[model samples]
Target: MRPQKIEEQEMLNGFAKLFKEKGYEGTSLAELAVVTGLKKASLYHRFPKGKEEMAKAVLLSINEWVEKHVFNTLTNPSLSPEERLKNGLQSIQKLYDDGNTPCLLQAFSVQSGIEVFHQLINDSMSDWVDAFTNIGLAFDLSQSAAKEKATQVLIAIQGSLIVSRGFNNPNIFINSLTNIEAMYTQE
Candidate 1:
Protein backbone atom coordinates (compact mmCIF):
# COMPACT_ATOMS: atom_id res chain seq x y z
CA MET A 1 0.00 0.00 0.00
CA ARG A 2 0.97 3.65 -0.44
CA PRO A 3 2.60 5.51 2.43
CA GLN A 4 -0.32 7.92 2.63
CA LYS A 5 -2.84 5.08 2.90
CA ILE A 6 -0.77 3.42 5.61
CA GLU A 7 -0.67 6.67 7.59
CA GLU A 8 -4.40 7.09 7.12
CA GLN A 9 -5.04 3.55 8.44
CA GLU A 10 -2.74 4.17 11.38
CA MET A 11 -4.77 7.27 12.16
CA LEU A 12 -7.98 5.31 11.89
CA ASN A 13 -6.67 2.59 14.25
CA GLY A 14 -5.62 5.27 16.71
CA PHE A 15 -9.03 6.88 16.59
CA ALA A 16 -10.76 3.54 17.05
CA LYS A 17 -8.71 2.71 20.15
CA LEU A 18 -9.28 6.18 21.58
CA PHE A 19 -13.01 5.82 21.04
CA LYS A 20 -12.89 2.38 22.61
CA GLU A 21 -11.12 3.81 25.64
CA LYS A 22 -13.05 7.08 25.90
CA GLY A 23 -16.29 6.67 23.97
CA TYR A 24 -17.71 9.12 21.42
CA GLU A 25 -18.79 12.02 23.61
CA GLY A 26 -15.84 11.58 25.91
CA THR A 27 -13.30 11.85 23.08
CA SER A 28 -12.17 15.33 22.00
CA LEU A 29 -10.70 16.67 18.80
CA ALA A 30 -7.62 17.92 20.63
CA GLU A 31 -7.06 14.44 22.03
CA LEU A 32 -7.65 12.92 18.63
CA ALA A 33 -5.13 15.31 17.11
CA VAL A 34 -2.66 14.36 19.82
CA VAL A 35 -3.25 10.67 19.26
CA THR A 36 -2.91 10.90 15.51
CA GLY A 37 0.03 13.36 15.63
CA LEU A 38 -1.92 15.74 13.49
CA LYS A 39 -2.97 19.32 14.14
CA LYS A 40 -6.67 20.11 14.57
CA ALA A 41 -6.80 21.84 11.16
CA SER A 42 -5.30 18.76 9.51
CA LEU A 43 -7.81 16.55 11.23
CA TYR A 44 -10.57 18.72 9.87
CA HIS A 45 -8.93 18.48 6.45
CA ARG A 46 -9.09 14.67 6.70
CA PHE A 47 -12.57 14.39 8.14
CA PRO A 48 -14.59 17.39 6.99
CA LYS A 49 -17.40 16.54 9.40
CA GLY A 50 -14.91 16.45 12.29
CA LYS A 51 -15.12 14.06 15.25
CA GLU A 52 -18.43 12.55 14.28
CA GLU A 53 -17.17 11.61 10.85
CA MET A 54 -14.00 10.18 12.32
CA ALA A 55 -16.01 8.10 14.80
CA LYS A 56 -18.38 6.90 12.07
CA ALA A 57 -15.45 5.75 10.01
CA VAL A 58 -14.02 3.90 12.99
CA LEU A 59 -17.34 2.22 13.73
CA LEU A 60 -17.76 1.18 10.11
CA SER A 61 -14.28 -0.29 10.10
CA ILE A 62 -15.08 -2.17 13.30
CA ASN A 63 -18.26 -3.59 11.77
CA GLU A 64 -16.42 -4.77 8.70
CA TRP A 65 -13.78 -6.45 10.83
CA VAL A 66 -16.31 -8.16 13.04
CA GLU A 67 -18.26 -9.38 10.04
CA LYS A 68 -15.19 -10.83 8.42
CA HIS A 69 -13.59 -12.30 11.53
CA VAL A 70 -15.99 -12.84 14.40
CA PHE A 71 -19.32 -13.26 12.58
CA ASN A 72 -17.93 -15.27 9.71
CA THR A 73 -15.89 -17.47 12.04
CA LEU A 74 -19.00 -18.36 13.99
CA THR A 75 -21.17 -19.03 10.94
CA ASN A 76 -18.71 -20.81 8.68
CA PRO A 77 -20.36 -24.16 8.06
CA SER A 78 -17.20 -25.67 6.68
CA LEU A 79 -15.73 -25.50 10.14
CA SER A 80 -16.91 -27.79 12.89
CA PRO A 81 -18.66 -26.26 15.90
CA GLU A 82 -15.46 -26.72 17.87
CA GLU A 83 -13.39 -24.96 15.25
CA ARG A 84 -15.94 -22.21 14.69
CA LEU A 85 -16.38 -21.49 18.38
CA LYS A 86 -12.65 -21.50 18.98
CA ASN A 87 -11.93 -19.16 16.08
CA GLY A 88 -14.72 -16.76 17.04
CA LEU A 89 -13.57 -16.65 20.62
CA GLN A 90 -9.99 -16.08 19.57
CA SER A 91 -10.89 -13.21 17.25
CA ILE A 92 -13.16 -11.51 19.77
CA GLN A 93 -10.66 -12.02 22.57
CA LYS A 94 -8.01 -10.27 20.52
CA LEU A 95 -10.41 -7.42 19.77
CA TYR A 96 -11.01 -6.79 23.47
CA ASP A 97 -7.53 -7.72 24.61
CA ASP A 98 -8.93 -10.76 26.36
CA GLY A 99 -11.55 -8.54 28.03
CA ASN A 100 -9.14 -5.93 29.38
CA THR A 101 -10.69 -3.39 27.02
CA PRO A 102 -14.27 -2.27 26.71
CA CYS A 103 -16.33 -3.27 23.72
CA LEU A 104 -16.84 -0.46 21.20
CA LEU A 105 -20.60 -1.06 21.27
CA GLN A 106 -20.83 -0.57 25.02
CA ALA A 107 -18.37 2.30 25.09
CA PHE A 108 -20.17 4.20 22.33
CA SER A 109 -23.60 3.52 23.87
CA VAL A 110 -22.68 5.01 27.22
CA GLN A 111 -24.46 7.92 28.93
CA SER A 112 -23.33 10.87 26.79
CA GLY A 113 -24.40 9.06 23.60
CA ILE A 114 -24.24 9.54 19.85
CA GLU A 115 -27.75 8.93 18.47
CA VAL A 116 -26.57 8.45 14.90
CA PHE A 117 -24.26 5.56 15.78
CA HIS A 118 -26.93 3.73 17.75
CA GLN A 119 -28.04 1.61 14.82
CA LEU A 120 -24.50 0.57 14.04
CA ILE A 121 -24.01 -0.56 17.61
CA ASN A 122 -27.28 -2.45 17.71
CA ASP A 123 -26.70 -4.12 14.36
CA SER A 124 -23.26 -5.30 15.38
CA MET A 125 -24.59 -6.89 18.55
CA SER A 126 -27.49 -8.49 16.74
CA ASP A 127 -25.08 -9.92 14.24
CA TRP A 128 -23.08 -11.42 17.10
CA VAL A 129 -26.11 -13.04 18.66
CA ASP A 130 -27.25 -14.33 15.29
CA ALA A 131 -23.83 -15.81 14.62
CA PHE A 132 -23.71 -17.44 18.02
CA THR A 133 -27.22 -18.72 17.48
CA ASN A 134 -26.18 -20.28 14.21
CA ILE A 135 -23.27 -21.97 15.93
CA GLY A 136 -25.56 -23.36 18.60
CA LEU A 137 -27.90 -24.72 15.93
CA ALA A 138 -25.02 -26.41 14.23
CA PHE A 139 -24.28 -28.23 17.46
CA ASP A 140 -27.72 -29.90 17.26
CA LEU A 141 -29.33 -27.67 19.80
CA SER A 142 -33.04 -27.05 19.36
CA GLN A 143 -33.87 -23.71 17.75
CA SER A 144 -35.08 -22.24 21.01
CA ALA A 145 -32.22 -23.86 22.86
CA ALA A 146 -29.75 -22.51 20.35
CA LYS A 147 -31.06 -18.97 20.72
CA GLU A 148 -30.98 -19.30 24.49
CA LYS A 149 -27.43 -20.60 24.44
CA ALA A 150 -26.38 -17.75 22.17
CA THR A 151 -27.85 -15.20 24.56
CA GLN A 152 -26.12 -16.89 27.45
CA VAL A 153 -22.82 -16.89 25.63
CA LEU A 154 -23.09 -13.16 24.87
CA ILE A 155 -24.06 -12.41 28.44
CA ALA A 156 -21.20 -14.49 29.74
CA ILE A 157 -18.73 -12.72 27.45
CA GLN A 158 -19.87 -9.18 28.27
CA GLY A 159 -20.14 -9.96 31.93
CA SER A 160 -16.70 -11.52 31.97
CA LEU A 161 -15.32 -8.49 30.20
CA ILE A 162 -16.67 -6.33 32.99
CA VAL A 163 -15.16 -8.54 35.64
CA SER A 164 -11.85 -8.74 33.84
CA ARG A 165 -11.65 -4.98 33.39
CA GLY A 166 -12.76 -4.27 36.91
CA PHE A 167 -10.51 -6.72 38.75
CA ASN A 168 -7.62 -6.58 36.30
CA ASN A 169 -8.19 -10.24 35.50
CA PRO A 170 -8.22 -11.67 31.98
CA ASN A 171 -8.61 -15.27 33.13
CA ILE A 172 -12.24 -14.60 33.86
CA PHE A 173 -12.72 -13.83 30.20
CA ILE A 174 -10.70 -16.83 29.06
CA ASN A 175 -12.69 -19.09 31.35
CA SER A 176 -15.89 -17.72 29.89
CA LEU A 177 -14.78 -18.86 26.45
CA THR A 178 -13.91 -22.24 27.86
CA ASN A 179 -17.43 -22.52 29.21
CA ILE A 180 -18.90 -21.40 25.92
CA GLU A 181 -16.97 -24.06 24.07
CA ALA A 182 -18.20 -26.57 26.58
CA MET A 183 -21.72 -25.74 25.41
CA TYR A 184 -21.10 -27.82 22.34
CA THR A 185 -18.78 -30.59 23.48
CA GLN A 186 -20.01 -31.39 26.98
CA GLU A 187 -23.56 -31.86 25.81
Candidate 2:
Protein backbone atom coordinates (compact mmCIF):
# COMPACT_ATOMS: atom_id res chain seq x y z
CA MET A 1 0.00 0.00 0.00
CA ARG A 2 3.07 2.31 0.12
CA PRO A 3 3.25 4.87 -2.64
CA GLN A 4 5.88 4.16 -5.32
CA LYS A 5 9.16 6.07 -5.01
CA ILE A 6 10.42 5.67 -8.59
CA GLU A 7 8.22 5.94 -11.67
CA GLU A 8 7.64 2.66 -13.56
CA GLN A 9 9.41 3.64 -16.75
CA GLU A 10 12.39 5.08 -14.90
CA MET A 11 12.70 1.96 -12.82
CA LEU A 12 12.54 -0.21 -15.90
CA ASN A 13 15.18 1.90 -17.60
CA GLY A 14 17.49 1.35 -14.66
CA PHE A 15 16.84 -2.37 -14.69
CA ALA A 16 17.46 -2.41 -18.44
CA LYS A 17 20.78 -0.59 -18.12
CA LEU A 18 22.18 -3.07 -15.63
CA PHE A 19 20.84 -6.01 -17.55
CA LYS A 20 22.48 -4.68 -20.68
CA GLU A 21 25.79 -4.16 -18.93
CA LYS A 22 25.74 -7.53 -17.23
CA GLY A 23 23.93 -10.63 -18.30
CA TYR A 24 21.24 -12.18 -16.12
CA GLU A 25 23.64 -14.44 -14.27
CA GLY A 26 26.17 -11.66 -13.83
CA THR A 27 23.56 -9.14 -12.64
CA SER A 28 22.67 -9.30 -8.99
CA LEU A 29 19.84 -8.08 -6.81
CA ALA A 30 22.21 -5.77 -4.95
CA GLU A 31 23.40 -4.21 -8.19
CA LEU A 32 19.87 -3.88 -9.48
CA ALA A 33 18.80 -2.25 -6.20
CA VAL A 34 21.67 0.24 -6.42
CA VAL A 35 20.94 1.10 -10.06
CA THR A 36 17.21 1.57 -9.53
CA GLY A 37 17.48 3.36 -6.16
CA LEU A 38 15.11 0.79 -4.82
CA LYS A 39 15.71 -1.45 -1.85
CA LYS A 40 15.96 -5.18 -2.47
CA ALA A 41 12.67 -5.72 -0.65
CA SER A 42 10.98 -3.10 -2.79
CA LEU A 43 12.19 -4.81 -5.96
CA TYR A 44 10.95 -8.10 -4.59
CA HIS A 45 7.67 -6.39 -3.80
CA ARG A 46 7.39 -5.26 -7.40
CA PHE A 47 8.68 -8.43 -8.99
CA PRO A 48 7.72 -11.27 -6.69
CA LYS A 49 9.37 -13.79 -8.94
CA GLY A 50 12.72 -11.99 -8.48
CA LYS A 51 15.49 -11.70 -11.09
CA GLU A 52 13.78 -13.76 -13.75
CA GLU A 53 10.69 -11.61 -13.47
CA MET A 54 12.77 -8.45 -13.58
CA ALA A 55 14.65 -9.67 -16.67
CA LYS A 56 11.37 -10.54 -18.35
CA ALA A 57 10.01 -7.08 -17.60
CA VAL A 58 13.12 -5.46 -19.03
CA LEU A 59 12.96 -7.56 -22.18
CA LEU A 60 9.27 -6.85 -22.58
CA SER A 61 9.89 -3.13 -22.20
CA ILE A 62 12.57 -3.27 -24.90
CA ASN A 63 10.30 -5.31 -27.15
CA GLU A 64 7.50 -2.78 -26.80
CA TRP A 65 9.88 0.02 -27.72
CA VAL A 66 11.15 -1.75 -30.84
CA GLU A 67 7.62 -2.62 -31.94
CA LYS A 68 6.56 1.00 -31.73
CA HIS A 69 9.62 2.87 -32.97
CA VAL A 70 11.26 0.38 -35.33
CA PHE A 71 8.56 -1.92 -36.66
CA ASN A 72 5.80 0.67 -36.80
CA THR A 73 8.00 3.20 -38.58
CA LEU A 74 9.20 0.63 -41.08
CA THR A 75 5.67 -0.39 -41.95
CA ASN A 76 3.97 3.00 -41.97
CA PRO A 77 2.31 3.33 -45.37
CA SER A 78 2.28 7.12 -45.33
CA LEU A 79 6.05 7.41 -45.65
CA SER A 80 8.17 6.52 -48.67
CA PRO A 81 10.32 3.42 -48.32
CA GLU A 82 13.52 5.45 -48.15
CA GLU A 83 12.05 7.66 -45.48
CA ARG A 84 10.96 4.64 -43.48
CA LEU A 85 14.43 3.12 -43.73
CA LYS A 86 16.03 6.34 -42.54
CA ASN A 87 13.66 6.68 -39.61
CA GLY A 88 14.00 3.05 -38.65
CA LEU A 89 17.80 3.25 -38.66
CA GLN A 90 17.65 6.37 -36.50
CA SER A 91 15.55 4.51 -33.98
CA ILE A 92 18.01 1.62 -34.02
CA GLN A 93 20.93 3.96 -33.48
CA LYS A 94 19.16 5.43 -30.52
CA LEU A 95 18.38 1.98 -29.21
CA TYR A 96 22.04 0.96 -29.25
CA ASP A 97 23.32 4.37 -28.19
CA ASP A 98 25.37 4.42 -31.40
CA GLY A 99 27.19 1.19 -30.40
CA ASN A 100 28.31 2.44 -27.02
CA THR A 101 25.80 0.15 -25.39
CA PRO A 102 25.72 -3.58 -25.88
CA CYS A 103 22.62 -5.28 -27.22
CA LEU A 104 20.04 -6.51 -24.69
CA LEU A 105 19.46 -9.59 -26.81
CA GLN A 106 23.17 -10.39 -26.86
CA ALA A 107 23.47 -9.70 -23.18
CA PHE A 108 20.80 -12.28 -22.50
CA SER A 109 22.29 -14.92 -24.78
CA VAL A 110 24.61 -16.38 -22.17
CA GLN A 111 23.88 -19.96 -21.26
CA SER A 112 21.95 -19.26 -18.10
CA GLY A 113 19.89 -16.41 -19.54
CA ILE A 114 19.28 -18.06 -22.89
CA GLU A 115 17.77 -21.19 -21.41
CA VAL A 116 15.02 -19.14 -19.85
CA PHE A 117 14.60 -16.62 -22.65
CA HIS A 118 15.22 -18.67 -25.77
CA GLN A 119 11.69 -18.57 -27.15
CA LEU A 120 11.28 -14.88 -26.39
CA ILE A 121 14.60 -14.12 -28.03
CA ASN A 122 13.88 -16.26 -31.06
CA ASP A 123 10.46 -14.73 -31.56
CA SER A 124 11.74 -11.17 -31.21
CA MET A 125 14.53 -11.86 -33.72
CA SER A 126 12.00 -13.29 -36.14
CA ASP A 127 9.91 -10.18 -35.78
CA TRP A 128 12.95 -8.07 -36.64
CA VAL A 129 13.64 -10.10 -39.76
CA ASP A 130 10.00 -9.85 -40.76
CA ALA A 131 10.00 -6.05 -40.37
CA PHE A 132 13.15 -5.66 -42.45
CA THR A 133 11.77 -8.04 -45.03
CA ASN A 134 8.82 -5.71 -45.44
CA ILE A 135 11.20 -2.85 -46.10
CA GLY A 136 13.01 -4.91 -48.74
CA LEU A 137 9.69 -5.69 -50.37
CA ALA A 138 8.89 -2.00 -50.54
CA PHE A 139 12.06 -1.52 -52.57
CA ASP A 140 10.79 -4.01 -55.22
CA LEU A 141 12.94 -6.95 -54.14
CA SER A 142 11.61 -10.41 -54.83
CA GLN A 143 10.30 -12.36 -51.81
CA SER A 144 13.34 -14.61 -51.58
CA ALA A 145 15.75 -11.76 -52.20
CA ALA A 146 13.95 -9.62 -49.70
CA LYS A 147 14.23 -12.27 -47.00
CA GLU A 148 17.91 -12.86 -47.78
CA LYS A 149 18.58 -9.14 -47.66
CA ALA A 150 16.72 -8.83 -44.40
CA THR A 151 18.76 -11.60 -42.79
CA GLN A 152 21.97 -10.05 -44.06
CA VAL A 153 20.98 -6.71 -42.62
CA LEU A 154 20.41 -8.30 -39.21
CA ILE A 155 23.73 -10.15 -39.40
CA ALA A 156 25.57 -7.03 -40.46
CA ILE A 157 24.14 -5.01 -37.62
CA GLN A 158 25.02 -7.63 -35.03
CA GLY A 159 28.47 -8.21 -36.45
CA SER A 160 29.24 -4.52 -36.77
CA LEU A 161 28.07 -3.89 -33.24
CA ILE A 162 30.50 -6.55 -31.99
CA VAL A 163 33.38 -5.23 -34.02
CA SER A 164 32.64 -1.64 -33.06
CA ARG A 165 32.61 -2.48 -29.39
CA GLY A 166 35.78 -4.56 -29.75
CA PHE A 167 37.59 -1.80 -31.62
CA ASN A 168 36.17 1.01 -29.43
CA ASN A 169 34.78 2.78 -32.49
CA PRO A 170 31.28 3.99 -33.19
CA ASN A 171 32.13 4.91 -36.76
CA ILE A 172 32.15 1.25 -37.70
CA PHE A 173 28.60 0.97 -36.55
CA ILE A 174 27.62 4.21 -38.26
CA ASN A 175 29.29 3.15 -41.50
CA SER A 176 27.47 -0.16 -41.39
CA LEU A 177 24.19 1.69 -41.19
CA THR A 178 25.22 3.86 -44.10
CA ASN A 179 26.03 0.77 -46.12
CA ILE A 180 22.67 -0.75 -45.28
CA GLU A 181 20.88 2.35 -46.48
CA ALA A 182 22.80 2.29 -49.72
CA MET A 183 22.07 -1.40 -50.18
CA TYR A 184 18.35 -0.77 -50.11
CA THR A 185 18.08 2.73 -51.54
CA GLN A 186 20.45 2.34 -54.49
CA GLU A 187 18.83 1.53 -57.84
Highest TM-score: give the candidate number.
2
Candidate 2 residue-wise lDDT, 119-151, digit = tens: 888999999999999999999999999999999
Query: In model 1, where do residues sit more than 4 Å from their true spots?
Result: 1-6
Give the runs in model 2 whose Cα sits over 4 Å from its true position.
Answer: none
lDDT of 2: 0.91
Per-prediction TM-score, please? 0.92, 0.96
User: What is the Å distance of residue 77 in model 1 from its true position?
Assistant: 2.1
lDDT of 1: 0.85
